[model samples]
Target: MIALNSIVSTFNPDDQQKFITYLQSKNKRRDTKNIQLFKFLIKEELSSKDICKQLYNVVQCNAYHALRKRLFQSIIDFIANNNLEDENSIDMQIIKYILASRTFLLQKNYDVAYKILDKAEKLADENSLFPILNEIYHTKIQYAPYYPKIELKDLINKQQENQKKHQLEDQLNIVYAKLTSLLNAISYKGEIIDFESELQIILNAHNIELQDSLSFKSLYQILAIANISALITTKYYQIENFVLKSYSILKQKKETEKQLFYQIQIVYLIANTLFRNKRFEKSLNYIQEMQELMLLKKGIYLKDFILKKTLLEALNLNYNNQQQKAIDLIEIAISNKHRDIEALLDLHLSLLMFYFQKEDFTVAKSVLSKFYHTDQWYIEKAGIDWVIKKNVAEILLYIEIREEDLLYSRLKSFRRRYKKYLTEIKQTRIFTFLNFAEQYYKNPEGFSTDITRNKIENAFTWTTVHKEDIFVMSSYAWLKSKIDKSKLYSTTLELIKKA
Candidate 1:
């Protein structure tokens, strides 16, 4: 049941209907039970034994298991064929052309063979389909001796040039893989990476040009890496210039229909980067551009980006003094039927932060409670950083409400889980900040606000205001507002304004 249901869950409702049609057309026997199993899987959550009993009117585990295996293979074949015929299958189409040309050439059909090669080469070149272009050139040169009107010297030169282009592609692929490793290190292993310096070294080692080597997909990956690095370091302002420049270069390229997905994500990254830098107006402008782009092609990728768009827009709106609008935006996006669990966790956490800032403790606690799953579950679904934030929020919310027992439990849990990691990463300031909160919660009358503020100012190594992360500042602001005897919401905004 789990095996078949996993594949079936990959299809959207429309695709499920299409799959039904697909099964009906491909059915070999008039009495096949594969379709019945598929429908049952989609519409119910019954166990394998229950499903088997329902389908067979008895416990026929052996027959049900065989049907499941067959259906799984059918889904795999369907997905493969569907992907090949998709509108975004330009590269696959070029490969198909190359294969057809080679077959025709073997049969001594020169007219059709050369014509197909020419067409494939043209499309491959236009799209910067370097890997496919490599195959195309190899085929052309392989048969250069057999075909007439073919300049062997010219074909060799073209192949060499193609090789050089794809060699650069190979280098970029290495850089991408290394960047992914570096990103995972920062995200989960609690390693402090100097991403900008590391990226510079990577580029130098690979001989990749800053401006020329990056194609659309490579640029998006680079931006994503930089964004994650910024997020982990709490220094978003450092990446603002680089992200903007990358997007400006991306804007000049003639974006193909297939590359639209990357373009929308690039735009979102730019908006998010700018928002982190407190450029709310510019961020909103880019978010508006992203919206216009999402409306293209009948909103095919809209659901894929709904949470991202809403999160960025809501953030911008929150900072722009439209707090209710921000809340409304997120609430609508949360109610969306999108099943991206990681993205949903992000939205829930951000909403929790918003309510906490508003000083609505009850609502904030409610929002925090929405993270009803275990810490281990969230760590798997999101990441260590998200789980850390969730734990901190829980502890702080309990502190606010003076729930001593819950606060102690959360404090113990957080220490056991993350203290060693944060300390190892040279992020002890987080511990210092949370400690102050706990101290204040335990003995507000005995807590020395002035001494705590002074200690925070001196003990914590602070970066320049412009380079500090907003969320980091927000966390600090809770202590600041308490020390200065001010409002948490305004203090958070003021810290961002200064930054």
Candidate 2:
């Protein structure tokens, strides 16, 4: 798994440039070595010796180590000063003051220490930084003997209050983490067997009452658990209630930058759930809301939100029987620079689906070509388990474009690669569909029958049973469209309507 902190850093070029600029501004001599070294470290894996030889032209190990330390320190300094205007900076500054106070206390400067603690306490209280306020209270109690002017009763009361807030935050955070872990576990599986009992256990254990969610963080965490549970259990309508609750709570307050990001996530979760439920118009409305928020905030995670919004819009259009419009939107999405390689791969796949559904075999083939070329890199970049889905799409593409030889080879390859796992996951329809598709490819004229076509349509329907979560299986409709001699999109829409 990718380290959590490094995940966002993977595609952040703007932050790197800002760090370089910050370093330049900080240095009196404008030394370029540190900036160059930082850039090299980010882009490549190199030893200290390699870095020393390349940048400093020295063989001394100690000298290289010393320079490495300085370079590391410079990066830290750059990050510290980069966004002091951000709201979280209040917490950061409070911590800094607390540390300063500690240093003063150690040096026997009681006056300076108490003054620093007072400043930190005021900032913590003003910002509702209860966690930091707890720290402030502890520090004040530690120095109480040195300063008898401190009111012990008042300090004790505030400390108790901060402690309660900290406990609440901690409980919410732990519950959120557990829910997030469960969500990740079920995401790829795309099915639920008996998660309701587990979810109830979590709620009971965590004492997670939505009514008790008094803070933004607590409310967001509560909604997140509900949203993820709804997803896992396929209870999509449940997501709407949580979404509304989150929106109502968030709108009533002044959101910090962090809260806004969480709000955006709530919007995404609801829109996605609506889309899954085939509420296309409502989904599009949420998508618009998300887009407006993106335009208003332009958060650092802009690329991800844009990718999601664009994909949701495309899916809404495609499922609503607007293949060409969906294709157009996907084209625009793929043309843009994307920080998320996984989303990019997904967009390419969606584009291929649109083209294939439209029976534009030539364009579909081209999209598949692009998909194949970039696929390996995307797998490496995103660490996604795409082997089954990727191979399945390729096989379907081959079938659509009438590449009989390629279709035969791809069918064999896909079965070999995913047969065991597909069976394990009870996704036998995928294997069945591939078998039917292979038969259809070799004998298109003889492939049609009420029995056989229904079976094939059932396979397609099974593939799309979790359409909101898993990749779409367009083979059934594609085959049905071919057998029925109808438009693929219209037939797929009918199948969806029936489903």
Candidate 3:
């Protein structure tokens, strides 16, 4: 029992051989108990080769059935000792050891089996053992003769390495596919699935050593892309630093295509961040840089498609600042046939604003009428489109003869019926409407007191409650002053002073 414990603890090949020799010298005919003990020792410690040799000798001496029965009992004893009845609970390392033993049991060479099992054990230790074990069990049942020991070992190692490389590549590909799907989903009113956990799983799989290889450089590029998307989705403001680090790594390897892709994404993200922060000119400059890169690439790349949309956004931002360059860019985009319905809609909205600024109500009304009649008008309101649709509502109110009462009632009804939707309305558009309503009431013509009061009050209640919204803060404060001149005036004055 002490010897058996040593064998189990050490698991050394030399210890196994000593047990095999001891078993062979024991009595085979005189004492059945001794013979059984010998067989048990053989099963417990020796390689399958030594066990099989003893079985053959017993059969030659006319004790074949007894030896076979003893061999079966030994197998049962080994399993019992190891407590391995439920193979599912066995650690991958132990399972690989068992597989190695079985390979020798089947009269195959030991070296090939040991190498394969070693690799499997390593993978199992990394908590990535499931796939490898599944493959082994699947192939073990269809056991064939082992003839290619050295070659098979080399091939298995190569394949395992290749599979690891492919997994990283596949993750990068998935990130791009998911980002494109998300953007397109927003365009088409489709739902986006939560991809954060899955992305983290992939990132965790990446090994720094693997990234140093030429074969994995392409995959590293993919990793960079995935990281960018994760940053964008999670609003990780430190994305520029993360991207710059990844870019530096890629640049060190001179991976130009990947570098270009990462650069485009970085530029896009920076432009988007600037736009959100209301840095219109900086956003336009970033978009122009993206456009220049796309032109340099002859418009054949994925970045080109992305830059086209961003260019429209930049133009819209410029138009918001009442710049003529915005109109020039829109005309160029429309004439070049690069403008989709989104860009055209943006252009129409810009033109309406431009006309409004110039007090050309006739052209503004005409342009807005055409915009309201377009297919995009309905498509933009499908609740999935990311662009604000309230702008259309705002324009429609401008041209309609009975707009004041009807528009106010419709907006109020929408707020009450779709309280959740109210949260989704763009803050910029909400503030625009609020400011417009307030200005209309303050007109020298003397607006209706009760109607204007209710409109201002409703806007105030909604906007002030969401006071973190920068666009609506001023309008909210102004409405408060109108509603309660004394208390609100002092509070609003303090708030504005702080701003």
Candidate 4:
């Protein structure tokens, strides 16, 4: 779908309104088809053929295609200009500085040009933007013959050093791309591959070493790889040390405006890892840091990360015996349109689970309604795993609401869609969970039986306390709550207390 209507679909109602205003400013004529076409696309839920017919009411096919291309190009320009205006957006600022310097350098304004280049070089170096730094150096060296004040030999040596650093970063990028490909293969092709061994192979091929002077940009990719490994193994704690070290290094670098984006991401990763490993307080602490960073540069990255921060905060609060507060946090956040659609889906499902735990089935179903799109839509927006989770939640919700027919029908579809995927990932416990849920649906009283408990335990095994995933424990706690005839919230809290 490429997100339904390219980047336009990414905008929520608020963004749509903002884009209208932007388009108004960009429009040279009052009777323009661009706005009309945009309004039509957003207003109607029609297929391409129908849309084409409607669009061609007064225009020929060639004009329609030309108008479509112009509208698409306008959207691209709007997004580009909006990002360029971002506070402390270093790359754009550096480019602007370079352009300004080049303008003066053309007129033999050596003094002014050198000052601008100096500023650009400092900004690029701080952000470890080697390619941009090379550009700055190239301009300086290019004009060296014209300006005698600058040292040509010094500039050449500096560029040579930067080229080496850039090459190293390129190697890290190779490893990063390889890791992404490996993960995609595992999911799309259902290939069984060892995470560590595959990661090692890529690192070896790239001649990367942990002991090297890895820059912040390199560490970001490495942390991403660590996150991927943690996800595959369910051993988030294993990467804790490396992530913390990277964050510490970033902190020691003393906050560059250009590195703010990476800083926000690294802090979020730290907070997420802690939350996954059952360190709620510490996780919340880092989340506080992340939120603070987001507020910087006039909250330029806020839209990018608000949902993620809220999801983490809500999770930590919920675990700390503040379920209502957590629920309230997410409720307020979910009302707005954010760019992090993946995180939006997470919050939607998390809120649904919270309502289900509270026995607020009415509210739970309402939250479920917000996920009004198809599973294919969700799989593209989130992932296949998230889609599977949603399906399971739907089936369970149907069972809770006493919709027997819907529950059975959803079960049949869920199995048909995900049975092979579950087997590929060796996560067929989902089937076991559905089986027990079905039995419970048949006879609620049977949940208290020793045989039912035995069946549940046989299907769901645990290696140790405080190691299993929070969501896994959540589903188990729901079943346990039914078995013990206790409150779902309390059962969940007591169960995860060990983790």
For candidate 4, write residues 1-499 as lDDT tens digits.
Answer: 2233656655657668878898899888887778777887776576555666776764247776777788888888777776677534778889999999999999999999999999999988877889999999999999999898889999999999999889988887888888888877664445577878888887888788764335666777778888888887778877888788777777767466556787788888899999988889999999999989998865657777888899999989988889999999999998875657788889989899888888999999999988889887877777777788889889989999999888888899888878887886778888988888898889998678778777788877675666787778888887888788899899988987877
Best by lDDT: 4
Model 2 spans with C-alpha error above 4 angstroms = 1-21, 30-72, 89-129, 132-165, 182-204, 209-214, 230-235, 295-298, 320-325, 332-339, 370-385, 446-476, 494-499
Q: Total clashing residue pairs per candidate?
A: 0, 0, 0, 1
The stretch of ten residues in a row with the least summed lDDT in candidate 3 is 208-217
lDDT per residue for candidate 3 within 1-499, as digits (tens), equals: 1233223333234434544454456436554443444544544665434544555643244354455555445534544544343333335355657566566746665565655655665544333333454455434333433443335554466556656655655555565565555544444453344445545544565432223322223434554444445433533333444544444553454323324444565556556554434455666777777666555433434423442454546344542444456555555555543324554555556555444444456766666667445334444443233233334334334533335675566455544543453344322445445455546544613443567667655544342222233234433554444444434324343444443
lDDT of 2 by residue, 1-499 (tens): 2121243243367766777777778767755576676666666566556777887787556665665667667666555565565646767788899999999988878889989999999866654577788888998888787777788888999899888877877888987887776665544443333456777777789776655455566666777777777755555655675667666866766555645566677778778877877778888998988887775533565655888788889999898878788888989878865557767877887787777777788887888777545434544553324545667777877876677788787777667755675565456776776777678778787876787777764554342344433234345666777678788788888877754
- Pairs of colliding residues, candidate 3: none
Query: Better model by TM-score, 1 or 2?
Result: 1
lDDT of each: 0.81, 0.70, 0.47, 0.82
Model number with the top TM-score: 1
List pairs with backbone clashes in candidate 4: 466-499
- Model 3 gets an lDDT of 0.47
Say which prediction, candidate 2 or candidate 3, comes out ahead on TM-score. 2
Against the hidden true structure, what lDDT does model 4 obtain?
0.82
Model 1's number of clashes is: 0
TM-score of each: 0.85, 0.70, 0.44, 0.75
- Compare candidates 2 and 4 on TM-score and give the better one: 4
